[model samples]
Target: MRTRKSETELPRFGEAEALRLDAADPGHRHLFHVPPADGGRHPESAYLAGNSLGLQPRATRDELLADLDAWGRLGVEGHLEAERPWLPYHELLTAPAARLVGALPTETVVMNSLTVNLHLLMVSFYRPTGTRTRIVIEDSAFPSDSYAVRSQARFHGLDPDTTVVRLTPRPGEDTLRTEDVTAFLAAEGDTVALVMLGGVNYLTGELMDIPAITAAGRAAGAVVGWDLAHAAGNVPLSLHEWDVDFAAWCSYKYLNSGPGALGGVFVHERHHGEPDLPRFEGWWSTAAATRFEMTPVSRPPSTVEAWQISNPPIFSMGPVRTSLELFDSVGMPALRDRSLRLTGYLERLLDEVTADRPLTVITPRDPGRRGCQLSVRLGEGSARELTKRLRYEHGVIADAREPDVVRFAPVPLYSTYHDCWRVADALAATVGRAG
Candidate 1:
C-alpha cells in the first residue's frame, strides 16, 4: 500500500519483487473484475495485453461523465456553448499529443484511425513519378500496413510486385539490423519514391532506428513515412528533429484511448506550405477563420489539420484526453525507465527457463532496440497451444501470432513486474506440458 520509487536503488524484479508489484498495482487490486468460474473465486489475471489494448484508467469515467453532462445540458449548443466547447476540442489536445510524439502543434492532428491516416498522408507524400515509383517496407510489417501500401500502389496503376520492395532479415536472423536497412536503401535509393515502415515491428517488438531510417530515406531521395501504431507511446521519439516527412499511429494500443479511438498523423513543417501537394479536402479542412462563412474559400490551415476530411467524433476525444492526461502526469522518460527494467527482467527470466529449450527470442536484445513486447519463437508449432494453456489455466494473457510465434508486452503504465514473472512461469509450464 506504500509508494515506492522505481529508481536504480530499488532491487530489480525477481520472483518476490514481481509478486509484491502485482499486489500493489492499482489496476490489478482495484479496477480489474474477474467473474467467478468453475464454481470458484478467481483472482485477477496477469494482463500482458497492453501492447494490444491498454487498461482503462480510473479517471476516464469522471472525464467522460463531465462531457456527457455538458452534452445533456447544452444539446446542440455544446458545439460552442459547452464547458469545453467542441468547436476547438481537437485543438485542446494538439499540444499534449504533439509532445507525445515530439512534433510541433502545427504538424500534428488527431482525426481518423491509423491506417486511414497513413493512406491520407500517402496521398500527399507518395507521389510516384515514372521510374522512381517504388515503395520500401519490411517483409514482416503489420498486415494492415502492408495491405494499405500495396493498395496505394495499385491505386496508382502500378504493380506491387515491382513497386513494393519488402526488406527481410538475413537467413536465420529474427530482427533487422540498422546496417541492413541502410544498405538496402543505399542500393535501391534512386528507384524508391517512398519508404513506408512500421516504427516498431509489431511481431518482433524491434524498435527501428527512426532518425537513421528517416535520414537514409531522405538521402536516397525517398519520402519517408512511419506507421507508429506500436512506437508512438512505447518509446521516446523526436519526429520533428528527425525531419520525418510524415507519420501515423493508433491510440487504442499503448495510448490506451479506448477501442478504435481516433488516430493521429504528423507532417513536418517543411511540407506545411507546399501548396502543390495533392489532398482530398472537406469543410473541416477549410480555414477555421472562415469556416462558418458558408463560402467556398478553400484556404486550408497551415498544418496537418488541413488533411482532415470531416468533423472528428467529439465523444472519441474524451478517452484520448483522459489517457493523455495520465501520460503527462507520469512523463515518458520515467515510464520508459520502468519498461526497460521490466522487459529486461522478463528476457532474463525466459532465458533462464528456456536455456536448453528450442525457444528463441525474436525481439532485439538491446533495450534501445525494443519496446516492452518480447516475441518468442517456438521451433515448431507450439505457440498457439502454449498460449491457450497460459490463458485458460494460468491467467496469463499473451497473444499468439501465426506460425510458431508468441508476443508478450508488459506495458509500464498499468502492468506490474509480477505480471511478467507470472507469464514467464506460465510459459515454462506451458512448454513442459507441450513436451
Candidate 2:
C-alpha cells in the first residue's frame, strides 16, 4: 500500500502506484457506479470510453425520477408547476454552462444536440458572399462535423468540393500545427466565409489553439466558430475572452450527461443584439416576455437563446442539470489539474507497456496540445479485434476507429489512476496476443 507522490513528483507504474494516485485524486470516483465486468466475473471493469460516452452520475436517477413525478402529478400543467418549473428549466443550466466554457450567461444556452446547434449557428455565421464563399475546417474533424459543413455549403447552392476548404496536417503528422492553421487562414481567410473546427480533434485528441486560431480567422475577415464536442468539459475554455464568433458542444462526453443529452451553444454578446444577423427562428426563440403572445412577427431574444427552435426537453435536460451541478461544485480548475496529471500518468504507462509493441500514441506529447483522451494507432494489428479482446478478455472498454486506431479517455470526474494502470496492463496483454 504505497502512497502516491505529489503532482510535482514523477509518476511511477504498478498497482501500488495506481492505488496511491487514486487515493490522492480529489475527484470522487465512487460517485459513479461502474458496471461490473462480463458475467459479473470481476469488479467494475476499467471503463475508459468517456470520450464516446461518459459514465453516468448517480444523482441523475433521482433528478430524472423527480421530473417523472412532476409529470405524473401535474399532467399538462407540469410545464409551469413542476418542482423545477419546466418552462424556465433551461435557464437553470445557463449560468453553469456558461461558466464551464468561460462565457457570459447571456452568451450561452443549452439546447438541441451538437450537430443541430452547429447548423443553426452556421445559418447566422456562414454568410457566404460573392468572394468569400467557402468554409474552412480541419481535414480530420469528426465525421458529423464534416458532413454538416459540407451539407451547409450545398444548402447554400455552393458546390461542396470547391466551397469546403479542409486544412490538413503536414505529411506523416498525426496532429495539426497551430502555425499551419494560422498560415492557411492568412492565405485563404478572405475567401472563407467561416472557419469552423473542432476545438479538440476527436480522432487524434489534439486540442487546437482556439484563441489564436479565432484571432487569425477574424483578422482575415472570416467568422470563426468551433465544434467543442471533445473540448468543452475536457479543457478550460475562454470562449468570451477569445472573442470566438460561435461554438457548440455535446454534454454526453466529458460533461457526464446521459447518452444523447442536450447540447450547449455560445454566441458572443456582441452578436446577441445584432438585428441583421440572419438566423432560423422558432417560437421558443422569441423573447420570454412576449413568447406567449403568439405575435405574427418573431421577435427573437437578444441572447444566445435566440437560436432555440423548439421548447426545451425537460426529461433530456434533467440529467444535464444534475451533471452540471457536479461540475459547478467541483469547478473546472480543480478538474483540469487532476485531469492533466491523470492523462500524463496514462501516457507514461502507455509508453512503458507498448515499448516493445507496434502501438503508437498519435495524440500530441505536449500537455498543452491534448486533453484526457489518447488515441493509440495500431500498426500491423487489427484495431477492431484488439478492441474487442480488451473488452471481452480484460474487461476494459475503449473505442475503436476504422482501420487502426483506438481511443481511451480517462475522464477526471470518475476515472482513476488504477483505471489507467488496468487499461495499460490490458492493452499490453492484448497486443502480446495479437503479435
- Per-residue CA lDDT of model 1 for 293-392, tens digit only, reads 9887678888888898888788899889887777787888887888897789788888865675567898989999999999988875567777777778
Provide backbone clash counts, one per model. Answer: 0, 0
RMSD of each: 5.9, 4.8
Candidate 2 lDDT:
0.88
Candidate 2 wrong stretches, greater than 4 Å: 1-12, 39-41, 433-435
lDDT of each: 0.83, 0.88
Candidate 2 lDDT for residue 21: 74
Off by over 4 Å in 1: 1-14, 20-42, 433-435
**1-435 per-residue lDDT for model 2 (tens digits):** 111234223224578888987777747777887877652145788888999999889889988999999999999898888879999999999999999999999999999999999999998999989999999999998899989999999999999999998888899998999999999889878898999999989999999999999999999999999999999899999999999999999999998898899999999999987978889888898998899998989888788988888999999999999999999999999988888999999999999866767788999999989999899998766778877888887788889997899999988988888888888877765565223
